[model samples]
Target: MKKTFSREGVDLAYRDVGDGLPVIFQHGLGGDEAQVADVFPDRPQTRRLTLECRGQGVSGYGPVERLSIATFAHDIEALADDLGLGAAVVGGISMGAALALRLAVHRPSRVRALVLARPAWVSEAAPANMKPYAVVGDLLMRHSPEKARRLFDDSTIAAELARLAPDNLSSLQGFFNRPDPVLFGRLLVAIAGDGPGVSEAEIRTIAVPTLVIGHGQDLVHRLADAQVLAGLIPPARLCTITAKSQYRAAYRREFRACLSEFLETLA
Candidate 1:
C-alpha cells in the first residue's frame, strides 16, 4: 500500500510491503518510488519500503534546490523515526546509493546494514561524470523534449554513448518522460552541481555488514566507484551485475542470487 508522510510540510509518498525487519530503499534521481523500485527482492521476514523522494515521485515538489542527496537522507531519517524502524537495513541505487551512504555516515546508530547499489559517487565529486548529464540539462533547458531528443539522438556523442554506455544514454532519455520538464531541468542542474555525499575517509568509518553492487559497461555508475567502496569499507562484499539497459538472463540470476545470499547472511 502507498502511505503518506509530512516531510518539511511537503507530502511524501512511499511503498510499504510485508511486515518484519524494516528494509527501506530509495530510488535514484528522476525516478519515483514505483519506477525505480524493481531492484528489491521480496522477503517474507522483512518489511520492504521504497520512498518517493521530493520532486521525483507521487510526492510534492517543494523547493527545487532542496531536492538533493543530503535532503533525501534527512527524509529517510524522518521516515525511520516515524515508523520506529530503528537500526533498519538501508539500501539504494545511483543517487539513492549516495543518500544511503550519507545516512549511514550521519546517523550511524540507526542503520543495521548497508546496501550500496550502483554507487555513482567516488570522492567528494564526480565532475567527469557530470558532463553528459549537464549537456542533457542544457538541451532540455533551452528546447522542448522533442527537439532535445532529436538533437541527442542524431549527435555523434549519443552514438558513442549508445555503444559504450547504453544505460547512461537511457538515463538521459528518461528525463524526457518526466511530468514537469521545467522542474526536471531545474533538478538536473541542481543534482549536477551537488557534491558527493561524503568523502572516502567518511565512508571508512562505517563498519556495518555491507553489500556493494556495481555493473559492467555503465559510465554513470562506474564499476571503479563500486570497487573503491568495496576496497575501503571493511568486510564489505561486492557483486557485479549487467546494466538494466543491457540485461540478460545470466545477469538477472546473478543479481538476485547475490542479494538473496547477502540478505540471508544478515539473518
Candidate 2:
C-alpha cells in the first residue's frame, strides 16, 4: 500500500510491505516506487520500503530550488525517522545510489547496510559521464519539448551515446517526453551537476556491510564508479551483472540474486 508523510512542507509518498528484515530500496532519477519493484527481490522475509523523493513519483516538489542529492538524502532520513526505524538497509539506483551513499557516510547509525547499484557518482561533482543529461536539460530549458527532442536527437552527444551507450541515449531521449519537461529539466540540471558529496576518505570510514553492483554498457552509471566504491568501503562485496541494455531479464535476475545473497549474509 502507498502511504503519505509530510516533510519540509510537502506530502511525500512511500511504500512499505512484507515483514522481517527492513530494507529501504529507492528508485533512480525519473523513477518511482514501481522502478524499485523491478529489480528488488520480492521475499516474504524482507520488508521493502521505498520513498519517492521530492519532485519524483507521487511526491510533491516543495521547492524545486531545494532539489539536490543532499536534500533527497535528508528526506530519506526523515522517512526513516517517521517510520520509527533506528536502522535499516539503505540502497538505490543511479541518483538513488548517491542518496544511499550519503546516508551511510553522514548518518551511519541509521543505515545498517549499504547497497550501491549502478552508481553514477563516486566523489567529485558533475562527473563527465553525466554531461549528456545536462545537455538534454539545457535544451529542454531553451526550447519546447518537441523542439528540444529534435535538437537532442540531432546533437553530437546523442550520436556518441547512440553508438556507445544506447540505453543511456534512450533515457536522455525520454526527458523530452515527460509530462512536465520543464520541471524535470530543472531537476536534471540540478542533480546531474551534483554528486554524492562524500569523498573517498569519508567513504572509507563506513563500517557497515556494503554491496556494490555494477555492469558494462552504461555511461551515466559507470562500472568504474562502482569499482571505486567497492575498493574504498572495507566490507564491501562487489557483484558484476549483465548490462540491462544487453539483456533485461538477465540484468534484473542478476541484480536480485546479488542482493539476496548479500541480505542472506546479514541474516
Candidate 3:
C-alpha cells in the first residue's frame, strides 16, 4: 500500500508491499515511485519498498541547492530509521544507485546488500559524464522549454552529441517538460556538479553482497563504471544489458528478469 512518511520536514511518498526481507529501492534522477513501477515484480517473500526521493513526485524539493546525492542518501537513512527496517537490501538506478552506494559507505549499518544498477558515479565525481546535464539545465534556464527542446532536437550541438552519446540527448529530452522547470534546472546543476560520491577505499570496504548492472549506448551510466564497481566491490557480480535509452522492450524485460532473479537469491 502507498503511504506517506514525514522526514526532514517533507512528506515523502513510498510503498511497502509483500512479506519477507525488506528491499528498499530508490528511483533514478528523472524518476519517481511511479516511474520505477516496472521494478520489483510481485514477490511473496520480499517486502518491496520504493521511495520517491525528495522533490521527485509528491516529495518536497526543500532547498534547490541541497539536491545532492548526499542529501538523498540522508533521506533514505531517515526513511529506514522511521520504518525501523534495519540493514535492508538497498539498490537503485543511475543517481539512485550512486545514492545507495554512498549510503552503504557512509551508513554501513543501514544496508544489508547493494544492488547498484547503472551507477552514474565512480571513485570520484565524473565531470565529463555530468557535463551534458549541466549544459541542458543552462539551456532550459536561458530559453523557453519549447525552444530548448527544439535546439536539442535540431541543433548541430545536439546532433554531434547524439552521434557520440545518444543517451545524453535522451536525458535532455526527459528533462524538457519537467513538472517544475525551475526546480528541475536547479537540481540538474547541483547533480551535475556533484561527483561520483564515493571513493575506491570506501567502496572497497563494503562486505555486503552487491550486484552491478551496466549497459552500452549509455553515456550517463557508462558500462565502464559498472565493470569497475563489480571489480572493486568484494562480493559484487556484474550483469550487462542493452541501454534503456534504446527503448527496446526486450532490453527492459531482460533487466526486470535479472533484477527478479537477484531478489529471489536474497529470499
Candidate 4:
C-alpha cells in the first residue's frame, strides 16, 4: 500500500510491499513507484519500498528552490525513521542512483548496502548534458510518438530504453508520457543546479557494500562513470550487461542475477 510522511514539513509519498529486510528503491528523474514494481516482480524475502521523490508522482512539491539531493536524502532518512527501519539496503537507477550514492556518503549509517543501476555520475568526466535532448524528446512525444520513437531510437538513449524488458519498456513509456513540459523543465534545472557531481574523495570513503550495474551502451550514464565508481569504492562489485534492442530484454536476466547474488551476501 502507499503511505505518506512529512519530512521537513514537506509531504513525501512511498509504497511498501512484501515482507523481509527493508530495501528502498529510488527512481530516476520522472520516475515513480511503478518503475520498481516492473523491475522487481518477486522478492520473496525483501520488504521493498519505492519512494516518489518531491515534484514527482503523488509527492507534493514544496519550494522548488529547496529541491536538492541533500534535502531528498533528508526525506529518505525521515521515511526510514518513520517506518522504524534502520540501515536498510538502498538503491536507485540513473539520477536516483546518484541520490543513493549521496545517502551512502552522507548518511552512511542509514544504508546497509547499495545497489546502483545505470548510475549517472562519474568522477571527473562530465557526460554530455542530455537535458536539452530530453526536452526535445518530450516535446516530440507530445506531437508525434513516431518522431519521439525515431529521435530516441536513433540515439544512444533510445537504445538504452529499448534494452529494458518489455514490462520495463512499458513502464518507462508511461513515465515519459507523464512528463509535463513545465515540470520537466524545472526538474531539469534542479538536477543541473549546484551539485552537478559527486567527489572522488567522498566516493572512496563509502564503506557499505555496493553493487554497480551498468549497460555498455547506455547513453544517459556512461560506462566510464560506472568504471570509476567501481574502482573507487572498496567494497564495490561491478557488472556490465550487453546492450540489447530493449534495455529490459537485454539486461533483465543479468540485472536480476547480479542483484540476487549481491543481496545474498547481505543476507
Provide the clashing-pair count of each candidate structure: 0, 0, 2, 11
lDDT (C-alpha, whole model) for all candidates:
0.79, 0.90, 0.80, 0.70
Q: Which ten residues in a row have the lowest lDDT in candidate 3?
A: 34-43
Clash pairs, model 3 backbone: 125-195, 125-196
Which has the better TM-score: candidate 1, or candidate 4? 1
Mark the regions of model 2 whose C-alpha exceeds 4 Å error after superposition: none
- Residues 79-163 of candidate 4: C-alpha lDDT, one tens digit per residue: 8887899889999877678778888887788899998887776543324544433444344435454455455446654455556
Cα-lDDT of candidate 1 = 0.79
TM-score of 4: 0.80
RMSD of 4: 4.4
Cα lDDT tens digits for candidate 2, 5-94? 899789999999898899999998888999889999867788999999887888888888898999999888888887888789999999
Kindly list the per-residue Cα lDDT of model 1 for residues 1-267, writing each as its tens digit: 689999888999988888887787778777777644455665668787888888777888888769676787888788878887878888888777887888888888988999888887756663576667767777788889899888878987688789998878887888877777777787777776675567788889889999999987887788898999999899789998877767756655666677778878877
At residue 181, candidate 2 shows an lDDT of 78
lDDT of 2 at 259: 94
lDDT of 3 by residue, 26-88 (tens): 888768777566755666778877888777777778877678888888877777788888888
Query: How far is 168's C-alpha from truth in model 4 (Å)?
Result: 13
Displacement of the residue 11 alpha carbon in candidate 1, Å: 1.4
After superposition, candidate 1 runs with Cα above 4 Å error:
none
Clashes of 1: 0
Off by over 4 Å in 4: 123-130, 133-180, 194-197, 244-247
CA shift of 191, model 4, Å: 1.1
